[model samples]
Target: MQAVAIMKQARISPQKARLVADQVRDLPVGRALEILRFSNKKAAQLIKNVLESAIANAEHNEGADIDE
Candidate 1:
């Protein structure tokens, strides 16, 4: 099962966030988080937060044992 998270009315511009997203695209959650954690961009933090929420939702709603 797949999980999703949405952040409405975020302060950052979509164009800026998309730049961060493009870099993290197709990466494993662990790897993505690593990149996000060390990234100096504000959008990286925003995307990281949403990704964490999605992972939590998958565990709670779908009972998927996402190990970390």
Candidate 2:
């Protein structure tokens, strides 16, 4: 699930939030995090957190390591 933190940080309208979330959704964790990291938007930090969570979930639940 996308984190609510994205909304809080970006101060973005609901439509924009949905668009941003949709853009990143289903993206590989590392690539998603990189996209967020270089972003100028405030929502980037929140997006990074969500991506990190997704990465952690994938690592623990699926025995996949994003570092590799």
Strongest candidate by lDDT = 1
Go through the candidates in order and give the C-alpha RMSD of each one to the true structure. Answer: 1.2, 4.6
lDDT of 2 by residue, 1-68 (tens): 33222124455566755665676778766677777788776556666776677667767777775666
The list of candidate 2 runs beyond 4 A from truth reads: 1-13
Least accurate stretch of 10 residues (summed lDDT) in model 1? 59-68
- Candidate 1's C-alpha runs over 4 A off are none
Query: What C-alpha root-mean-square deviation, in Å, does candidate 1 show against the real structure?
Result: 1.2
Predicted structure 1, TM vs. truth:
0.93
Residues 1-68 of candidate 1 have per-residue lDDT tens digits of 56899999999999999999999988888899999999999999999999999999999998988884
How do all models score by TM-score? 0.93, 0.58
